[model samples]
Target: MNMREKTTKAENTPADKVEIAVRLDSELLEQIQHLTNDPSKVIEVAIRQWLRGEILRDDELTRTPVRTPVPPRGEWND
Candidate 1:
């Protein structure tokens, strides 16, 4: 309806959001920005890594291994 509302909305709107909050130290935040050139990009990269790890972990859990259990030594009937 007004310029102020439009400006506020534009600034507040996130491209995508997860309803969560995370806190980081100022030094850490600065470090991430320095390393990635964008703080948000660092967060995005971290989220991607975390998701990938979950996928790998799930895959390992669901994969079937072909291995027979070994019994005690010298227990075979001649």
Candidate 2:
């Protein structure tokens, strides 16, 4: 059993949160390391990307209300 196999089995065990694996080749891993060495950050970015695509596919992320642009200081005079 390799490191990944162990991780997969461990993730399968019942827990409060389920886990998913993202397999990267050596070259890809090196590229990611150039940007960040934090594994949690990398996982978070991947998950966010997945959710973005899912929401877009379902048309659920559309029509976010735009916030009113803030005026320059003294321009608002509020």
* lDDT tens readout by residue for model 2, 1-78: 776556554466568555567787889888878888865477677778897874345445566778999888888755
TM-score of 2: 0.36
lDDT by residue (1-78, candidate 1, tens digit) is: 876556643366576754445699999998887797657667877788898874356767888998998778887664
Pairs clashing within candidate 2: none
Give the runs in model 2 whose Cα sits over 4 Å from its true position: 1-22, 54-78
Candidate 1's C-alpha runs over 4 A off are 1-4, 9-21, 54-78
- Model 1 residue 44 distance off true place after TM-score fit, in angstroms: 1.0
The numbered model that scores best in lDDT is 1
lDDT of each prediction vs. the true structure? Answer: 0.72, 0.70
Each model's backbone clash number: 0, 0
